[model samples]
Target: MARKSLFITAIVAVMVLGFAVSAYAIGPVYITWNAGGANAGTGGPHQDYRLTTEKCAVCHSVHAAAVSNAAAGEFGPDPIGAAETQLLLRSSVADACTYCHITTNVSGLQIYNGVASNYTTDDQYGHNGSTSAECADCHAVHGADTFKGFIAGKILKAQGNLVSNVSGGVQTEAAATLNTLVSGGTVFTAPAASDGDYQVTAFCTRCHKTFSDASETTITAGGYFEEWDGSVTFGSRSYKNHPLKAAEATFVASGANYSGRVAWADAYTCRSCHAAGNNRVSTSYGGPGGLVSWSFPHWTNGNAQFLVSGWGVSDANIGLGTSGANTGKPSGSHTVMDGAEDGVCLRCHTNGSSGPPNNATAGVNVTF
Candidate 1:
C-alpha cells in the first residue's frame, strides 16, 4: 500500500512539470512574404533587398512615375527633376537617397546630413554637400556582384581608388576600379589588423585616401599607421594615439573598465569608433549654434574630427585653459588640455581616481 501511494505521487508531479514546459514553449519566427507590393517582403531599413521584385518597385515606377515632389513613403513624392535614367524615383542619385534616408521617411536608414529632411547643400559638418560622390557612388542599390574588379560584398560599391591586395606587407591599389563592401548585414565589426587585406579599412580608404596603410610611406596622413605608431602634435605637446589593432594583453593593465569601454579585445577599429545611431546626434554634443554641432553621413562634428561622441574643440576652444575646455568656453590663449579632461579620451583612459594610474600621461599634460 505504501509503495503504491509513493508511485502515484511521483506520477502527478511529472504531469504538472510537463504541462508547465508545454505552456512556455516558444514557436519559430517566420519571415513575411512579398505579394507584389513595394518593400512588401522581409525587408526592413538596411535589409531592403534580395527578397523579391516588389522591393525594386519601392524605388522604381514602370509607367506612372510622377514628376511632382509627392509626400514621402516606400513610393514617396516623385523626383523633382526630369525622368531618371533607370526609372529611379528621383532624378539625381543623391536626391533619391535623401528622400528615404531622411528622419521622417516611412522606412529605410536615415543618413541625412542636414538639419531638415530635405537636402541641405551647405552642410559643413560631414559628407553632405559634396559635389563629388553621391549615395549611389559608394553603395550598390541593386547589389554589386560582377561589375567591379572585386566584390567586397554587402552592397558596398567601390567608387574611388583603394588598396585591392595586401601581401607580405606590400599593398596594391585598384584605382577607379570596382569593389564591394565586405561582410554581411547580420554581423559587422572591425576586422583585425592581421586580416591581410584589412578589407573594411580598404573599403573606407577608397575615398578617404589618407586613412589607408598603403599611403603610410609618402603621406604623414591620418590612417592605420598614424593611429598605431604616429603622433599628432598640438600646441606645445605631442600626443600618441591608441593602437588600431594591437594585442589584447597591451591593455591588461588598464583596469576592469577597459573591457567595458571597448567591446572587442583587439583594441579599436574603424567601426568601433564610428557608427550610426540616435545617440550620435548633433544636439547630444552641442546644438547647431554651439561649438560642437555635428551632422551625419560621415559622423563628424564642426571641429571634432567626426568622433562618435566627445567634446569637440573648435577654433574658439583650441587654446583655452582647463576652465575653458571643461566649460566649453573660450578665454585666454592656453595650451591644449592644461589638466582639462575630455569625455572622449577619458572613455578609455581613466582619471587616476579609482584603481590604476591613468595611462594617458605624456610627461606632464594629458594627451588624448
Candidate 2:
C-alpha cells in the first residue's frame, strides 16, 4: 500500500509540473495590471512606478495555457462562439487583468491589489461602461492606435469645477473672459454658473452626468483661449473650464472633412479603430501623434497629472533611458508630464515620494 501511494503521488506531481510549464510556454495574448503593486506605499503616485504587459510571462501560463483559451472569450468559426462567457480565462473583466496582476501578497512577487468590488462608488462619476473591465478587452499591445494601446472608442470627458483665479488688474474680468471665447466651445464662455474660476473635470461625469452645483461657480469667462484649449494642449492647473463640452468626435483620424477641422482636436470627441502591427519588435516608438491626453489629478488629489500612454485603464511604466524615453512617438517631447502603458500615469515623472510633506502626511494619517 505504501509503495502504491508513493507512485500515485509521483504521478500527480508530474502532471502538476507539466501544467505549470505549459502556462508559461504558450503564445497567449498578454494582459497586465497588478492589484498588489510594486510601489504600494513608497511613491510619488501609485501609477508612476508600476509595470505592465509588455513582457511575455506576464500573461501566458507555461504550465497550463488553459486560462489563455478561457480568457480569449471564444474561438468560434462563423460568429466566434466556440465557448461560453465562462470559457474565457476569466468570468469578470477584472479577473483576467488580476490574473497576471494577482493583487495578493504572494511569495517571490512585489504586488499590491485591492479587493474586486461588486459595486462602484466612483460609478456615478467615472464611466457607465467603466466598471472594472479587463485590460485585454480594451487594449491592443502592438499596433495600437495612438501610441501605447489607446482605445479607439468613444472617449469621455471630466465634469467638475473649473478652478481658476481672476486677475485683479482686469475690470469685469469675468465678462472680459466671456466675450473672448470662440464659438462651438463655451464652457470657456459664460452661460452656466458664474464663479469665473477656471475649469475642472471629474471622472464621475466622464460621460454625461448632471453635476450637482452644490458649490456653484457662475460662468464669468466664456472664451477658448489657445492657451486653455484642452483640445491640443491641456491648460495650466488653474485653467477655467465649464460644466461640459460637447465632444463625441475626436479619436478617429480624418477620413472625412470636419468642414476643414480634424478629429482628435478635442478631449472628449474621440473614436478608435486600430490595425495590429505586422512586426512587434521592429515597430516604431512614437511622438507628436500617438495617443495623447491631459492627466487628471485622480490619484494625487489634483496635484499629479497621469500622462497616460496605453488604454484608458492600462497604466504602465517601463524604465526609460534617453532613447526609450519618447518611444511612443517618432520624436519625444518631454515637458512636465508623466506616461503610462495604457494611458494612465502621474503628472511629474521627475520627483519621487517627495510631495507637500506636511499636507500629505496629515492626510495620510486620517482614516478613510
Candidate 3:
C-alpha cells in the first residue's frame, strides 16, 4: 500500500507538470529582452535581471507606478497630478528607453551614446521635431509585423500642410497637397523581381516627403527620390547613381571594386553606407550631435552628411572624394567627409588608392 501510494503521487506530479507546460506553450508571447527568458547571452541586452515571469510589468504598472519628470530632472519630486500614459514607469517613451538603454552599463546593447537631450540645435539632426527624440516613433517594443527590427509602420501621414510645390518662379502646389510616396516595403527578405531594392530610401522618404518628388517645389535643392530613382544620369557619364535596387549578383559583376565589399547575396539598402560603423571612423563623430552612434540609420556621423564614408555620393557631392578629403565638399552649410578613411570609397569605385595616398585623385579619380 505504501509503494502504491508513492507511485500515485509521482503520477499526479507528472500530470501537473505536463499541464503547466501545455499552458505555457499556448500562452501569448510578450516582448522582452530575451523573449521573457533568463539571460540572453551575447547578441542580447546584458542585464542582470530576467523576465522570468512578468514581462509586461517590466515596463508598465497597474497603479501607483514610479513617475519620472524630464523637465524637472530624471529623478525629481513627483507632482501632485502628474500621470504617465498606460501606467508606464517613465513619463514618455523616449524617457523609458533612455532609462535603461542609457542609464545602465550593459555590455551587448549600450545605447547611451545614441540618446540626445533635445533636437533644437542645427547639428542635431534625424527625427528632429516635438517628438523627435522619442524611440517609439521609429520602433515598436512589441515587435513589428512588416519590418524586422521592430519598425513601427510604413506610409507615414503628414499631420498638416507642410510642403508647397514650386513652379518656375511661383509656388504651384499648396501645402494642403497630401503627397503619398512609396517606400522600400520590407527589408532582408528574399528579393522580388520588380522592386527588390532595400527599403531605407523609401523609409526615409516617408518623413521627408519633399525630397521624394522632384517636381515638388517645397524643396529648392534637387530631390533625392528623382536622383536615385535609377533613371537619372551621372553628369554626362554612363554610370548611373550607384544602383540601389540592382540585384547583388549584378552589382558584383559590374566591377571588381564592389567585390567582397558588401554581402552580394543581399539587396543593397540605404543602410549599406549610412549605418553606424560603416564609415570606418570613430563611432561618435559629431560631438553633442552624436549622430553616427545611433542604431542603424537613425544616428550617423554628420561628418558625411548622412552619407556612409568610403562610398560614392548618395546625393550630389555627399560622400568623401577620391583624395579622402572633405575640404571642399558641399553639403548644405555643413562640410562633410573629414577625409578620415577616404579609402572606404574603393569598396565600390574602381578609383585610385585606399590607404594613406589620401589625395583627391587617390581612388576612382572623381572630382566631386
> For candidate 2, lDDT tens digit of each residue in 10-117?
999999999999876644433343323543322111112235323333333233334223423332111212332332333333343333222321212211112223
Please list the residue runs of candidate 2 whose C-alpha ends up more than 4 Å from where it truly belongs after superposition: 1-54, 61-63, 67-94, 100-113, 118-122, 125-143, 147-368
Q: Per-prediction RMSD in angstroms?
A: 20.5, 20.3, 15.5
lDDT of model 1, residue 137: 56
| TM-score of predicted structure 2 | 0.24
Candidate of highest TM-score: 1
Candidate 3 lDDT by residue in tens digits, 191-303: 33222223333334333233211221224322223234323221111112333332232224433554432322121444433433222121121112122243333334354
The backbone clash count of each candidate, in order, is: 4, 86, 14
Cα lDDT, model 1, residue 269: 36
How many backbone overlaps does candidate 1 show? Answer: 4
- Predict model 2's lDDT versus the native: 0.25
lDDT of 1 by residue, 1-368 (tens): 99999999999999999998888653221122222245433323234355543445545555434445533332344335443433545344446655444532233223443233223453323455364345565566765331222222234544333233321111233221112222322112223322313444445544443332221234322222223323332222122333344323223332333432221122223433332111121121122212221222343333233333222222112211112211232232222221122433433343232212434332113432
Which pairs of residues collide in candidate 1? 70-77, 152-180, 152-181, 300-306
